[model samples]
Target: MKLARATFTPGVLGGPGFFGGMFELPGGYLKPVLVSSCDGVGTKLKIASVMGKHDTVGMDIVNHSVDDILTCGAAPLFFLDYIAMGKLDSALVADIVKGLSTACQEVGCALIGGETAEMPGLYHGKDYDLAGFIVGIVEKDRIVNGLTIKPGDAVLGLPSSGLHTNGYSLARRVLGETPEALSKVYPGFDRSIGEVLLAPHVSYFKTLQPVMSDVKGLAHITGGGFTDNIPRSLPEGVSVRINTGTWDVPPVFELIQSLGQVAPEEMFRVFNMGIGMTVFVDPSHVSTMLAAMPQARVIGEVTAEAGRKVEIV
Candidate 1:
């Protein structure tokens, strides 16, 4: 209760109720829409349990949910989490909550409330699952839904921090389940496989804040990777042409592909490969967008191609 109260601002969220909590948003908008998203850490939690690393996964769920809402040009207002485990461990719960608080503070979102379940039969051993729900607000006219995307609009790729909470199931299978397999030193990467795979998912709220108005579309590269996620923001009759070699593919992806003997096309379809987010910008605003995000690169462009929604060259 204290932790939840600490995350709320006085005017935004209402006082607690007997049955449930109250959330109050100040009213004064020409057009306001509430955008909500729910996401989980997936099989990444298995690796976290194996390694006994609980702190970063909290941020993973929060960041992942924030990015989903961000795709609709919304600013996060509050976040709620769900934690289920075989048995409740106070220390583990606190560590996870600490991470949630830290991430929510960074993104300026409130950790309003959450549920923790202790189900000995449902979950086995120390295993637990995490899910996050976030709500944000966006003005109607300010929403970027790729309707403005044109054939010549530039596609900018935002670098990802490793897998970014996706592809862990395939990665684990390829790397093996034992600690020795995870600890083995792979060529090209200075850190162990565990370290690289555990990198926190980057939140684009801060990076895209300045250029949100300039973006025609935004895609949060999650489960679908480039093939599926990018098309979500693309309008009808338009498609994306991505130049795969534009940016250096991270070594972790290379190792996964090599060891798993996964097809090149499948790699782009499964993992983020390298780019975590994709933004469509008008040719005129490309320079300004680039200036705001120096790390972004021109990985592709919008096209008027028929049938195909995304193409990787």
Candidate 2:
């Protein structure tokens, strides 16, 4: 098999070691329940590459991909990645793979296979892009699409670690390039801008795994922040009202807001603000679910409306 012929040792390569080991279809035959999602690190890679920190990006890609399919309530089975750079460096690639392998292993998913490209001119030297494909499976009856989400459901929010792979384009513009500028630690931050911006995208698979089946819908707050991402999982006629002060905002967000003069509403629209993933659950299970997932807070509640609306307060 292709996995066997890989130049890296069986375990050294992501595919053979991480994802390939844990996932198996119910039957011996090839046909099986499958769910897949694809995503990239977005402009966050620019920060990593600029800082010469190629290590955490693999985590960003895997976590981002994992969150994409997790919206479907299916646990990840395996992941495949694509890495393209103007030139290839074994050390850099290894750092990326190490992060990928660590994430895949923690989530109990396989890092199945991928393609790496060393283009001549398409990419500027040392500048690269990463994308990942993830596959998951759920029973015919167990899939958790938002079809069941109804008005009056409780919206539980999982805290984000910062921007989490979104809004970096604007972020870079607001905060100019320079290690000294970036290295100046924001209040409450022991690290610098580079560290916060490069913070590995948080993975919710483990935290939400136990309660996945009980929730009606799940939303991964990504590029569009709560305004855009939350609606993707809402049923017709249902909207969400979020309390802005429900959780303490991470200081990094405050710095961005203060520096960019980012409006309160605009901040919520552009960044995770604080909440990363939101789960809509039935009233009956809300208490139990919140108790189980301590990292979550009752940020909002679902309601019937003409269209999906996200309220900051």
Candidate 3:
């Protein structure tokens, strides 16, 4: 297993120091429970592929996998990645590994190993894709599967780091890849198009882990945005009512909305907009969770309805 390497990004927040440090399995634990999740970076890779950058893709995979299991109240133990490409460039591969190593260290998980398949004729030359699998553990009683999400439960929304690995296909259509276009800067952007598109995926393991027990349901706002993913963690006769003006939508999303002529409903359906993860928590403990995670805001409340839905007020 030749783990992919990443470009050495030197800083306290770069590699091992990026996260709080490695975490050990809980000692004196009864019935060690294992949880796992597998996800790819989705067509967001198209932007990276067009930009000829590969380092951050590895971090994207790591963060996304970590969030998946964190929703189930699992602490990430280790991560494995799969990178397939038409050809292998040592520099590109190194960049991927470096990002993975940095992200793994940050989240206190081990980047034990991974695979790099150099399959010619499979992927187009100069094109690659990433998928990751993560394993984590928790006590049997600590899993958060939404069974406890009641009608009065509060929904807290965590701000995202831009797009975070979803809705790129449409994003690309709205914002294409010409040298001039990629080099130009938006009004509020201090970075160029490539820079924004390559921004690392946000990891929530440390942010959400401590409060998972109090969380009745955890929703990772991904592909279907809040509209689709939130319902998966919801129980029957319950839905979420989202307050639309609770947080400022990131400008990048606004760019997509304006350029794509995307309806508010479709925008929520495709992108995180700004909020990445929504947590359904007890009304009483909502303040505690919010205090622990200052970035999280009360976006909505759970409700009993005919079907699962997200009403964006």
Top candidate on TM-score is 1
Candidate rank order under TM-score: 1, 2, 3
Displacement of residue 273 (Cα, Å) in model 2 is 0.8
Better of 1 and 3 by TM-score: 1
TM-score, cand. 1: 0.94
Tens digits of per-residue lDDT, candidate 2, 196-242, equal 89988899989888888898888899988988988888877878888
* Candidate 3 wrong stretches, greater than 4 Å: 1-27
Stretch of 10 with least lDDT, candidate 3: 5-14
Q: What's the residue-level lDDT of 83 in candidate 2?
A: 84
* lDDT-superior candidate, 1 or 2: 1
lDDT order, best first, reads 1, 3, 2
**How do all models score by TM-score?**
0.94, 0.90, 0.90
- Give the runs in model 2 whose Cα sits over 4 Å from its true position: 1-24, 27-32
Error of 2 at 274 (Å): 1.2
C-alpha RMSD in Å of predicted model 2 compared with the true structure: 3.7
Per-residue lDDT of 198 in model 1: 80
The 10 consecutive residues of candidate 1 with the worst lDDT sum are: 1-10
Q: How well does candidate 2 score on lDDT at residue 116?
A: 74
